[model samples]
Target: MSLAQWHNKRPPAATGLRLDFDDGGSEHVSTTTTSSALSLLSDQLATQFDRYKNEMARMFQDHVRIVDVVDRVDSLLAAGDGEAAPDCQREKEAEASNAARHGAELEERVARLRAEAAAWHPAVKPPCPSL
Candidate 1:
């Protein structure tokens, strides 16, 4: 029988899947069995879909974290580049000031040493060497 014929002939009380062929071949699957199988398949698909969603979310979060880290690093690098010249200039100024202070101190010590030397008189004069 054709599918339409089989559908028409189906008993009102029947609750099952029926497959009918043109040559009068027919197969009937119990509703309970089909429903259970379908339910199992649906459950499996739902579980796999959930897993896929979770994996995608984790990957997206990882990507965002990496992007954030890269952005922070770029900002720090930019800041460093901007500050480097001023840092160098400050260091140079400090070194110059220190050198000036050291030079003045040394000159003052030398002057003091000369004054001391000029005022000192030896208790005995050394013998002069004939040239």
Candidate 2:
């Protein structure tokens, strides 16, 4: 769904605290005091987390697929059937090459995502006096 629809669909009543920031800007930030608002915020965070997890999984899967394809090709080559050894080797090499490239791309995408996520929200521990 669109973000506008998501933002427009709020709960009937909010029971949580309201937080606002005014930096002398025209934009006004508002939050509700109900659990629903917190829940909504939590859900949004969860969605992002899930997306990250999915990306990671996809990267892993890509690597696994490459390995599986390569292994299949190797198996075919190892069969030693005098008839199609060369053809099998050629086809397997091509498949392996394609899978390797795809896997590399997936890894790069995952790395970029991880870097972006780290920049967005780095892990913190304990309370700091600066805050």
Candidate 3:
């Protein structure tokens, strides 16, 4: 029932390990070895459980992040499709073409004006000098 009683109740009946010099002491090598091995196994199991839990947490986080990214991509695709309809694309292309044509016409006008100035001001040696 008590520590002293348990220790005192048993005689010097241990194996040859404790083996007192006067043959009065005792020891339990097998029992201690078995207990030590069990303790080590329990510690290893706890360590492995902790590692497994951390790995699972990381996996769940990554899964959540991937799901969020997928949701964003899906929404972007939905919005893109709605905004980039066929008519919208055609309109954008037409606008771009018109702008390019206008730019080219402006460039041609500038060139024509420069040539006219050069022909009208040959003796001046410089075109649009006042400008």
Candidate 4:
């Protein structure tokens, strides 16, 4: 029978009568049977939704903790770099000082050699020959 005929049909006189219908292969439930089924379906859906929401909340908390750890690691690396900068500067300064000291020592040695050579020279030294 068509859906309109079924909808217009009067409720059975008996209190617990079961009415079977065939409405072109589609399900059609009467108000009498739907109340309990709908209630069970709503309860099941609510429980599943709550579980899904809780799982998503846990995953979000884990992501937040991971981000916090990454931020701390990055800050530590930055602090290490900051600390290394002064050590590098000190090393460069020490190298420069050593180079300057070595240059002064070499100059003094050359001056002393020149003085020694002058003292050992004869009263009159021979002039340089033509190339």
True lDDT of residue 55, candidate 3: 100
Candidate 1, poorest ten consecutive residues by summed lDDT? 20-29
Kindly list the per-residue Cα lDDT of model 2 for residues 1-131, writing each as its tens digit: 79999899765444443322323231233323345678998999999999999999999999999999999998887786787877989999999999999999999999999999888775655687884
Which candidate do you rate higher for lDDT, 1 or 2?
1
lDDT of each: 0.82, 0.79, 0.84, 0.84
TM of each candidate vs. truth:
0.42, 0.30, 0.45, 0.41
Q: TM-score: which is higher, 2 or 4?
A: 4
Q: What's the CA error at residue 21 for candidate 2, in Å?
A: 99
Residues 1-131, model 3: lDDT tens digits: 89988887756555755554444322355567778999999999999999999999999999999999999999998989976798788999999999999999999999999999988886675456674
Question: Model 1 over residues 1-131: C-alpha lDDT tens digits?
Answer: 89999888855443343533433323333556678899999999999999999999999999999999999999998889877888989999999999999999999999999888777756447889999
Off by over 4 Å in 4: 1-30, 82-131
Clash totals, every prediction = 1, 6, 0, 0
Best by TM-score: 3
Q: In model 4, where is the ten-residue run with the lowest total lDDT?
A: 19-28
